[model samples]
Target: MTMFLTIAVIVLIFVVIFQIAKASEYVSVLKGEEVSRKQNNKINGFLMIVFLVLGLIGVWYCNKLYYGKTLLPHGSASVEGERVDSMLWVTLAVTGIVFVLTQIILFWFAYKYQETEKRKVFFFPHSNTLELIWTIIPAVTLTVLVIIGLRNWFLFTGEPPQNAAVVEVTGKQFGWIFRYPGKDGAFGKKYFRNIDPANNVLGLIWEDELSHDDIVTEQTLYLVKGRPVKLIIGSRDVIHDVGLSHFRLKMDAVPGIPTTMWFTPKYTTKEMKEITGNPNFVYEISCDQMCGNGHYSMKGVIEVVEQAEYDLYMAKQKPNYLDVFPDKDPAAAKADTTKTVAAKTADTAAKAAAKL
Candidate 1:
């Protein structure tokens, strides 16, 4: 009801203005002057064109102000987002000019031919030249735009550089994990036997294989800014999507196989750290594809740190933490129990064989 009332009030105001303008246009006629409004049609046409241009300009600027991304964010491993951001201003410029020109042409035609009973029509039949020119110009314009867009698209998703840094991204129902290959260029396979039930140890816990190569156990990823980072993403249990709104990078993290994207950082991690007044450059990573109930809270952070800091950080990670149990004496106490069970199983097998 409030919306209706507001709309009605706006209509009434516009009607009042229209009536006033009409009256002013013929004020001399009302005062018994012999002049007709048709004499001033050229002036009215110019005024209408001005109003049309102003209206379109206002709408264009409003759209730019309302819908836009922030200029700064931490590094992202996708380039398409940055390309779109760069092209947005150009899109606005072209759209604004077209909008203003269209409106001006419409209003000028309407006001220039305002109702005049004494005027005779000047009729010209179809002109193939004019028709062909109009059609060809618009076709060329659209083709140019399409070509430019496709070029950017190809540039963004093209094969990444050979030396791009690879980071493994794994997704779960309610959280994210980033695995970095520690010191070794390759990541060790994970086996399920190593999973500790007491601790909520997630992912394919590769018990026997965690020792050949080290995996950094930290939740957040730390990378030096200005370096090319490639993210190889996968999911363990169900389908999930990796989305970073600030960086404009969103991609699906699927199970069974890995999906990858690459990007180079424009800003240094140290610069962002100082600007945000924190040692970390926090980028919110959320799952775009709903895989479970806790999907809304599924989050991850990327920390852009200096190269030296990142090196020191990787060096401090405990490589054998997964295999190292705090209480190591339990195995010694349970050794005799394991031998007794094996002996009982052998005796039962021998008795069964004799009975047969």
Candidate 2:
């Protein structure tokens, strides 16, 4: 529906441009009223033929070289996507009806009295009935649409089903970190300095007491079909947005607080593959916020895998993946920082002393 609308708008733009060009040409060539009017009418028939051929050639070449026969990736699993699909179909139907009616009325008005000698314009002004009809119709239609949209919005935000699983996701300047509570099913405290690169603790580390059994999985998100999943989101360094195009869901993941979004997959992995023409489908999760330089690459993949596969993957992940690093003495850590600064200052002083 959106594609059709885009094409229609493009064609309309081109038509207006052609008309403007023809009007300009006619004005330039006009010498007398009779000659100018005849000249203007002739422009449409011949000009359309010439331009149509040129346009067809350009379109064919563009399609061959650039577009091919590709379908867009629609990867949303949220209710908002379904609402948009419904809105698209209704909008197309109404727009088509309006377009046909408007063109018919315009052409009929123009063709009914073309000749200046034979046609006499009639003026019938100030009809309250006509004004009332046009005003009332549009007001009622707009009101109805608004009401329906509000109703849908209410339902969309109502509540997630009882069995929905909650997953916490945090965003940084150029990466996404997701936390799935281990056996306890709750998130543990996290600190940045405790992160150990060698141990694959890819960022959810904390300095305070950390739970030994808190397993934090890092890779990609995997979910089961027909299940509701709630994502609690936030940012660590800066504000970021979590956007999933196919599901029609986007929410800001602001720092210091959590935001939430929910989705349920209507199709299983096998079904989505058949529908989308891609067997190994992964929803591209993107950051909509201009967080930093690496924002462009800050994307994560989500796969709606089979229940069996999900079970196996979960089983393989160790329960103690988020184990806290050994406790560091605060005094020792501060002493190290002070010692480093002192060493640099002493080296600078030695160089000055030698120069003196």
Candidate 3:
């Protein structure tokens, strides 16, 4: 059987290793323990040097191999994200210098300072100057990095330009719902209790005139290229995150608390496809938070276009109000009114028949 063969092979390998160890012990006794230890130390020291050289080379090789595959080569997709990229590069440069220097000094000392009769270990314990240098330098460097990050964070979360296009992003169980304020330039009042999965996706109060003009869409969001857009974010069921990697922005979508982030588009989706040399390039909205079972499927798309194209796209979208109350949709016309009434009557009659 495979199990019996596997066990027998393991036992044989252990016996062979034990015999080799016993032979080595007998050889050490013949050579003298002190000389054997010295020889082993020399070999280990040489291996340390070899390891240091190979490690440094491996580091260089890895960077050369994978650096091009990262977003750093393509640069940022938003003007604000350019600051993020700058901060990232600065952090990498500073840490990289420290890493290479420390590694070289560490492994070089191990190899060069191997036990020898010519040298004796010094008893010097600690130096205040050395401690201060190590402590102060890293502290100041981290403080500067933190301050830079905070400044960028404030700029991103703050109120955007007056002409900025605003979109309300609501995260649900397995998808994203985007609401754009129509001509009125205001989002209508929304209540969670008014939620109806069939049509009233965002639970906007129909009584509000603002809700009548509020444009709602799913799967894709459209924005004007080179225009600043503010996102008002929230979640319906649990916590979710709106991750816009291209813009280098993300915000949590909490159930009761709303969050906001804004960014200006540097290139249209079409332009990005051309720039990246990919025909199917699209801006993605990824859920950065783990909400529920269907979390992986929660995704959305963004289409950045010119002002005229954006206008045409908006013009074609019907308001959420019309979908919720089809009777009020002007496109349905008066002829459809009777059908609506008939459907309601049929529903009521069907319920009555069921009860009987």
Best candidate, TM-score:
3
What tens digits encode model 3's per-residue C-alpha lDDT throughout 1-356? 99999999999999999998798788779999988878878988999889999999999899999997766777888888898999999999999999989989988899999999999998999999999999999999999999999999999999999999999999998899999998989999989999989888888898889889999898799989889999999998899999988888899999989999888999999999988888998999999999989989999999999999999898899998887777888778666877899999999999999999
Q: List the residue pairs that clash in candidate 3.
A: none
**What is every candidate's alpha-carbon RMSD to the true fold?**
11.3, 13.7, 8.1
TM-score of each: 0.60, 0.63, 0.86
For residue 58, model 1's alpha carbon misses the true position, in angstroms, by 3.6
Tens digits of lDDT, candidate 1, 1-356: 99999999999999999998788767856754445455565567777878887887787788688644444333233345677565655676777688767777789788877657777888999999999998998788778777877777565446667776777788876787777765567666664455443432433344535433455453577666666677888876799998866556667898777787666655554565665567855656788998888888888777766678778887766543344542433444488779999999999999999999
**Candidates' lDDT values, in order?**
0.68, 0.69, 0.91
Estimate candidate 3's alpha-carbon lDDT, on a 0 to 1 scale: 0.91
The clash count for each model shown is 3, 7, 0
Better of 1 and 3 by TM-score: 3
